[model samples]
Target chain A: MFAFFLSSGLFLGWSLGANDASNVFGTAVGSRMVKFRTAAIVCSVFVILGAVISGSGASHTLGKLGSVNAIAGAFMVAFAAAMSVYLMTLARYPVSTSQAIVGAIIGWNLFTGSRIDTNSLTKIVLTWVACPILSAVFAMIIYKLVALYIKFMKIHMFKLDSMTRYGLFFAGALGSYSLGANNIANVMGVFVPVSPFSSISFYGLFTLTSAQQLFLIGSLAIAVGVFTYSKRVMLTVGTGIFQLSPVAAFVCVVAHSIVLLLFASQGLERFLISHNIPPIPLVPVSSSQAIVGAVIGIGLLKGGRGIQWKTVAGITSGWIVTPIIAALISFISLFFLQNVFQQKTYRPVGYLITIDAAQRIRDGGVSEEKFKGLQGREFPTAVKFSNALSEYTELTREERDLIVLSAQMDEMEITRSGITGLDTNWITPEQIAALELLEGRVFDHQWQLDEALAEVSPYWRFREDDDKYNRDLRQKLSYIYRFFRYG
Target chain B: MSKGILRKQIGIEKQIDEFLDLISESGLIFKAGIGAYLNGKTDDFLRKIEQITDAEHRGDSLRRTLEERLYIQTLIPESRGDVLELLENLDSLLDQFKGAIWQFEIERPEIGPEFHEDFKEVVKYAVESVESIILSSRAFFKNIAAVADHMHKVSYWETESDKVSSNLQRAIFRRKDLSMSHRLQLRDFARQVDNIADVAEDVADRLAIYVIKRSL
Candidate 1:
């Protein structure tokens, strides 16, 4: 049953690999600087590693946007998104999995009557607009620097050709890695809420959670897609768009990779937040947009003469239309899945107003006066409860969900000592040492706590596991160290 | 048929155009050498011929480098033989310029005042013919449609050079005041000068055929 449900996510992963993977190595392979076989092999290996390691950060933000609570809902949403992308691909349009998945999630949110976190949605949309612009700026700067360096050094023709080839290979690898890290959320983010597998520990050295396992499987599907379907797409991008010099190709790939890394790197976000700088929103960005932006950047730098503005406008229209189509498809599909298939598309849960819920909402900085008339009121969904409560007091979707989750919980005593007494079997010695060092420090968010601990002991930071160990430790320590939740 | 490979082939063709430019530069130097000789500046003529020799050497090295690159890169496998043949023929045109200029520098043939204008006219026609061949060669790479016009000019200039050379040779031999050896020597110099136009016409003919093959 789980396997059947997971196939849709894998399908989406495959299509993502088929389409977006070309943006990474298309120019290199198309220009014949690197062979198609070599590019595919390198892209597959790095994409898998990236997906398994850093894929979770962007998905966490998607989860905040809307948690598709049922496995059936997740499957249908993924199917809808995949179908839209596949249909767009067949029509020879540029497909953005990011926009498709976001639209699908919104469809799910609307159908399940979940309150959409407007802040997170706004951030995602803003990044969509910013991703290509940022890539263009980065490409222009990098292209100029590389051109100046080549000019200053007066490199030989053959030597410059060899250097460009090497640079392309390196950039292609980084681009592949960034693609997997940022876009994996589009493939497996819906499944994360209803992940079927349990945490499996191997030899007490490492553990694989259900979400990571799902990501690994999706990444494999993506790798297969790259090996099989990406060749033609790569050739088109390499030669069909414009004539890209080897150096221009490298700059474009590098610029795209940097944009993906910026949006996907939780460590970078946390580093910024800790230094009193606003963090970049962790969102699944479109690799297609980034690459196009980079290409346009290089084109504009060369006086903008040869750029196919008509094609660019066409692609932009596709980007705008894809998400809306996916959303409509997901909504209609969910309706059919619920009515014809008789599947549980959403869990039927009700939230009961309790003292604990009211206190938590108050603690969240919502006014208690807003809850005056809603005492003991039973609501069918968190969205319904929050919709009523929002009339008097402004409440975000995340805070509303938190309040509803607390309201649904049975009364239980949670003491600081009791949390400390919980088993720390999975905690490493380095984490324990860092936790001790941070015994006196205060953190505004759970990630800040982990970042502070990571600063004290670098071993507390695991790059290969998506910071899972720190998250687990933070979850365990949250009982003793509670923080106010607000937008 | 692959666009990727086709684009790369265009890059190699561009390099070939640059190589033709170097050949054209050598032709111009050859013309300058003849002009200096006609002006009775023996030292200036030798110096101009030396510069023509340098241009020939540079053209030879550039042609070799281009051939090596084409062979190594295999940028245009199907047209490789035709392109190499065309380059070899074009290199021969430069060789004619170098050979004719060196002959004049070494022989230092004395010319009568009456035949000087005719000799200079032969040199002008020959140089113009080579210049037309260079334009046709460039058009072969850039604009195939323009190649025919330039090739026609090449043939017209080559014919003009032949007429001028024959008239000059007739005038030199008809001079009873000159020694037979001197007459033969002067005729040989005029024939050598006319040979440049013949070589350029041959290259232009080959280039026309190559362009037709490419367009086909």
Candidate 2:
């Protein structure tokens, strides 16, 4: 059953590979500076490495927006997104898989009555807008520098040709790596919450987490797509589109790679945060859009006569239209899958405000009067509960979300089997010891186990000053949350 | 792989340099051949003719080899067409030089004493024009920014050659002592030698456009 459902995500991965691979290697192959065979090999190897190593950062943001909690639901969400991409592309509308997946996830959220995290949504949308603009700026700067160097150095034409070919190969590699690191979330992120695999340890040298395993499978599908179908796309991109000199093509590829790295690199984010600077959000951005922005930058640098404003307008319209189309498809397909096909798309999560839940809400700084009437009332879904909270309380969105989180009812039991199921490669011994202490404890809410674990060991406790450690802790906590809930 | 690519580049660079050297050497040989012909040294003139004919054949062979290597390796793809056109034009300059020398050998034109210095001047100017255009073509391959520095000199020498060729033709036609056939033959030889400079100027014009197309 898991294999059957995961096929949709693999399909999405394949299509992403077939299309987006061209964005990185197209100009190189088009100009005949790099052969398609060499490009396909370098692209496949780096993409796999990037996916397994750095794929988690962007998926974290997607998980924040909405965690599609059922395998069947994840399947339909991925299927709908893939369908939207295919349908829109067939209709000659430019589309982004990133936008399509985000829309499909939101559709799942609406269907499940889960509250959408507006903050995450805003960050994602902002990155989408900033991606192309940043790429254009990088391209212009790199182009000027390269042009000046070539002029002043007085390199031979043949040497410059050789150098540009080398540059294109390296830049294509980097672009493929960034593409996999940033965009794998769109292919495998929806299945992360319901992933059936556990962390696999290899002689204590390394571990592949459940999410990493899913990413590996997804990236392999992408590699297959690159090997099988990307050659035609590459040829078309090389010759059929904008005619760029080899040097300009190299510059554009470097610029595109840099933009994708800025949006997807967790190390950069951590470095910025550690230095007391605000971090750029790790979001999956469109690789095609980045290349277009780069080409436009080169065009504008050459005095703006070469730019086709019509293509720019077409891509801009795609940003707004692709997601809406995907959302409608996702919602409609999910409805049929749940009712007509008799699949369980969601497990209804009931909300209750017990005495302990009220105490937790009070601890979060919400006034007693705000949620007074909402106490002792049970709601069948988050939508009913939020509606009740609004009727009885005058609170801000954050405060209302806090009430919903605090009052959410999730029955968890830290059983012997659950404790044994935890991978020591991921969980520290001290953290596992804490879990062992609460082995038979039953908790009515997920936060109760968190509180218990924090009390027993400082290893599980989050510190305010250490952002990196806290981020890791949050991941472990979420993983533990799902482990105990399902086990 | 990188080492292999560099080896291939070196091989092609050597071939291109060899090709350019042939053109430059032909210009020098053409000037020497014209001097020998005007001095009436039959043996030296014939030797120069053979040397020039050999140079022209070698230049043609080198050009064909270079064009084949470029297509086979797919090097400098964006500029490949331009480079091939430039090579063909440069080869034509060699043909013009060889053709003029052959004309001297065939017609054995009777030159009067007064026209000797004028003939040398026209040949000098035409050879200088070829020299300048050769420099421009080399710059186009090795240092594109320096191409402009040498390109304009081709037209300058061409104009000087035109002046010398016209004065010599007028001097030849003005002489009533020579027959109409003799005057016409001398005039045709002068024009033939001056046409080398004219072709060099046309090549410079094409090189300018190739430079622009290659500019970043």
Best by lDDT: 2
Q: How far is candidate 1 from the true structure (C-alpha RMSD, Å)?
A: 10.4
Clash pairs of candidate 2?
A30-A238
True contacts kept of each: 0.00, 0.71
Error of 2 at A21 (Å): 0.7
Q: What is the DockQ score, from 0 to 1, of model 1?
A: 0.08
TM-score of 1: 0.64
Candidate 1, which segments miss by more than 4 Å at Cα?
Answer: A30-32, A35-37, A52-66, A181-216, A231-241, A262-264, A269-285, A360-369, A386-487, B1-216
Tens digit of per-residue lDDT, candidate 2, span A1-487: 8788889988878877777788899879878888888899999998998899988655443342236767688788888777776664444333467777778888887888876656656755775577778888989999999988988898888988988898888888887887788778778876776689999999999999888999999999989878877776665445444567899889888888788778766688889988989888666556776776777778788887766677567656766777777778889999999999999987677899889889988988988999888788889888889988877867897788788988888888888887777667778898999998988888888788888999999998989867667878888887677667742
Write model 1 residue lDDT over A1-487, tens digit each, in one string. Answer: 7778879989888888887777889878766777888899999998988887888545443332235657788888888888887776665455677678777878887787765556646755665578779888999999889877865674533345555677787788887887787678767766665677887899999887777788889899999988888876676566555567777888888888888778766677768867878777666566787787788887788778777787677667777777778778889999999999999997655566677557767877767665657778877766787777787466676666656555552222333343354334544566566666655454333444544556888765545634434554444444323212121
Model 2: lDDT of residue B94: 92
Record all residue pairs in model 1 with backbone atoms less than 3 Å apart, i.e. clashing. none
Q: B67-108 in candidate 2: lDDT tens per residue?
A: 998899889989999999999999999999899999999999
Full-model lDDT for every candidate: 0.73, 0.82
